[model samples]
Target: MKIAMWSGPRNLSTAMMYAFGNRADFAAWDEPFYAAYLKRTGIDHPMRDEIIAQHDADSVSVSAQIAGPVPDGKEHWYMKHMGIHMEDTPLDWAEDCVNVHLIRHPARVIASYAAKRENPSFWDIGFQQQLEIFERFPGPVIDSADIRRDPEGMLRKLCIAIGLEFDPAMLSWQAGPRDFDGVWAAHWYGSVHKSTGFAGAEGALPELQDEAAKLVAQAMPFYAKLAESKLA
Candidate 1:
């Protein structure tokens, strides 16, 4: 099975990827369309040039690569994708995959993202794009907060919802980068690379001020649209 796990940046996405990648039966891909997205939009992200040079810069090739094989001969594939990365790519490749949506509270997303990249725009967080994909694929959605609060419990529920068996290996993983990490890992994956498992439950919603607050207001509706169907 090809599991297309869609999420936004700073939303515990890398940790979830690690959880699934830890499973012996699954092979994982990290942000397959990142390079293509960068190349297409010419966005000045950190390591932009390096990422395009190191990875497939063509969305067509990347799409075929993902849809063609279960890498390493694994029984399942877990692909961690950011919705914003789908900007210029077609959804045709995802047709056969078990498309699942991953979400986080907009306030939490904004707070974490702003720390890494200052003044992140609404589009940068990918909430609206995530909702667009949810509408097209119409599959299960899982919240990062729910997963952090009870990793195994929520993951087990996630597995059941997606017609897969729960694997204990999804609970933790070795710290540090994996072979499949995107070249931009050095820029975006610092916190996740150091994590061995999902962090503990988050505290009260952060009180956002100024622009950050407005950004959250823009994202909350999209986030709430998907959160309604997230695995409880």
Candidate 2:
């Protein structure tokens, strides 16, 4: 089976990727369309040149790669994708794979993202794009907070939802990067690369600035709708 776990920035996506990568039966992919997104949007992200040079920049080719075979003939493929990356890309191909939505509270996402990119907009945070994908191809939605609070419990529910047996290996992984990491890992994966397992729940949410507060307000409704369908 091919499973696509869709998430926005600052979510537990990398940790989830590590979980699936630990499974012997699964071949994991990290943001396969990132280069394509950067190329299409000409966004001046860190490592922009290298990322475009290292991976296929065409959305069509990247989509084909995702729909293609699991590497090394693995029994299953687990791909970690950013919802915003699919903004200009087609979605029909995704129908062939099991799509999983990974969400985080907008406040948390905005805070974390703002630390890296100043003055982030709704598009950068990806809540709207995530909602669009969920509407187009509905699937299981798992909150990052839920997984962090109870990794095994939530992951078991997720596995059952996706028709896969929950493996204990999903609980932790060796700290550091893996082959499946995208070329932009240097820019975005610092904390994740140091993590051996999901971090515990954070303390009180940080206060958002006026602009960010407005963005969060805009995202909350979409988040609430998806959260309603999240795994218990």
Candidate 3:
């Protein structure tokens, strides 16, 4: 089985990768198109130069690779992807995978994202692009907030929904970077790397102001549309 999890940054993406990676039968991959996106867009992300230099910047090759095989001869492959990273690259690869959209409330997303990179544009957070991906390859949707509220229940439901046996290993994992982390892990994966399991239920949604508030407002509609189908 190949699972393609479509998501935006500052969501629970990394932790979810770790969860699936911890499962003995699954091999997890961090964003496959990150380097390609950075190369194509020339966005000045935190470690753009290093990310492009270290990871493959060839979108065609990247696309073919993800479509090709589940590496290490694992029973399943779990790929974490950022919707904003996709462009003209073909999405035909998604047809073979159980595609899932993982979403977070924009207010929470905006607050977390702003702390790392200031003054983000609407596109940076990925709500609109994710909706586009969902519209095309419609599948199950999961909310980070709901997962935080009940990791075990939600994970069990997700596994069943996909016709995969539930693995208790998904509920916890060793804390630290995996050998497969993207080159940009240093800048982005700190908190998740330190976590042994899902953090407790999140607190109240953060209050945003000015640019952050405006960006959240712009993202809310898309987030809501996607959230409408999230696993309850």
Candidate 4:
């Protein structure tokens, strides 16, 4: 099965990628559209010029690389993508794959992102935009909180959606470094690699400033809308 995993920034998308990539039968590709999006929109992404300088904003080439055939006859392939990527022009590559949308509480997500000195960008906004995106897509959408709360159950549901039987093997994966992960792994997910199970608490990251908190509060309606949609 070809599966595309979509999520917002700092929403455990990378760690989830690690879990799926751990499977010997799965091949994973990380954040391939970002360079292209940055270039095409001419938006100021955090690593803007750096990424464009390296990849030259060639999304077609990047899309090709992302959709390239897999090796070892892996039955499943996964690609990690950010939700903000869905725009006026959708990727033709995602047309036939099973899509899994991962969403998190905006308060926690934005707070976590701000703690890391990360900019929220337009992608961080909750509600109408995000809700519309989720509702338009026909696929399984998993709440990040639920995934963390019940990894096993959620994984089974995910497997079922893609026409695969639940493999107890996916419940837990051995943690380690592997190729196919983005270079940002070392910086963003260092603590995740060392964890054996879910890291219960949202660690002691810096608190969001009042201004940021207010902004997140304003986005709560959208978050609530998403929570409702996922439950529905």
Q: Compare the candidates by lDDT and give the number of the best one.
A: 3
Over the stretch 49-166, how does candidate 2's per-residue lDDT look in tens digits?
Answer: 9999998888898788877788888999998988999876887778999999999999999999888878888889898888889988899999999998889999999999999998
RMSD of 1: 0.8
**Runs off by more than 4 Å, candidate 1:** none
- lDDT for predicted candidate 1 compared with the true structure: 0.91
Candidate 3 residue-wise lDDT, 75-156, digit = tens: 9999999999997778998898899889999998888888899888899999999999999999999999889999999999
Residue pairs in collision within model 4: 127-222
Q: Where does the lowest 10-residue lDDT sum fall in candidate 2?
A: 201-210
- Give Cα distance to truth, residue 200, candidate 1, Å: 0.5
lDDT of 1 by residue, 1-232 (tens): 9999999999888888889999999999989999899999988898999998998888999899987979898999999999999986898989999999989999999999888889999899999999999999989989998999999999999999899999999998888999878888898888888888999999999999999999999888898889899888
Worst 10 residues of 3 by lDDT: 207-216
Sorted on TM-score, best first, the list reads 3, 1, 2, 4
Clashes of each: 0, 0, 0, 1
**Which should have the higher TM-score, number 2 or number 4?**
2
lDDT of each: 0.91, 0.90, 0.92, 0.68
Candidate 4 residue-wise lDDT, 1-232, digit = tens: 7787777777777778877877878888787776777777887645567766664257667667556776557878888877665565456777767776777777777776776656664455433455665666657777777777778777777777668777665555567665775555555566667765554535343456777777677776766766665622
Return the lDDT, model 2, position 74: 96
